[model samples]
Target: MSAAAGTGAKRPARRGIVLALALAALVVAVFVGANAHLVYVAVTSQPDCVPHAKEVGIDGAPLRAARSAC
Candidate 1:
């Protein structure tokens, strides 16, 4: 009877651990899927950091600053 009680207690503990792990996996999957599109864009597309690549002294920061000044 004592051994049966020990086994029963362990079953719930083991189930709880498994449930926690499964929940964590689910959350991770959702987070990754949500960001997958942005990840693909960043990886596959070349970021237009420099607006005028040929023009000397032209930077994105200046353009962004000019736009925000409005």
Candidate 2:
């Protein structure tokens, strides 16, 4: 009877440890997924640049700045 009680207590403790580890793994997976999405957006998106018409030189000449594929 004492041995059976000890085994039952150990089973619950083992289950608790397994649950904690699974929760930790889920948190890590979510964190990694969010970071990956952010990286993808940063890589795929383009930056906005000032248009050529908006810029003018001091000598009244139109400044042809480097154009971007906006």
Candidate 3:
């Protein structure tokens, strides 16, 4: 019947739209997850002020061995 044929065609279009939306959501989730990990590392990581063995008199050298509060 004509109605059955129209409904069948619309079903495929609706499925395609749903599939596209799911794929887009998956991409967005992956991107957000990666950025979240980077943010966490940046927040939780601490900087270390290591003394250079050879280059002692550098302009920005630390006066003493100390841990940075980065």
**TM-score for each of the candidates:** 0.55, 0.68, 0.72
In model 3, what are the clashing residue pairs, if there are any?
none
| Model 1 TM-score (2 dp) | 0.55
Candidate 1 runs further than 4 Å off:
41-70
Each candidate's clash count: 0, 0, 0
- Model 3 ranges with Cα > 4 A deviation: 52-70
- List per-prediction Cα lDDT, in the order shown: 0.73, 0.83, 0.80
Any idea what lDDT model 1 has? Answer: 0.73
User: Judged by TM-score relative to the true structure, which candidate is superior, 1 or 2?
Assistant: 2
Winning candidate number (lDDT): 2
RMSD of 2: 4.1
Residues 1-70, candidate 3: write the lDDT tens digits: 9999999999999999999999999999999999999999999987775545334456666453343433
TM-score between candidate 2 and the true structure: 0.68
Instruction: Residues 1-70, candidate 2: write the lDDT tens digits.
Output: 9999999999999999999999999999999999999999999987776445535574475665555454
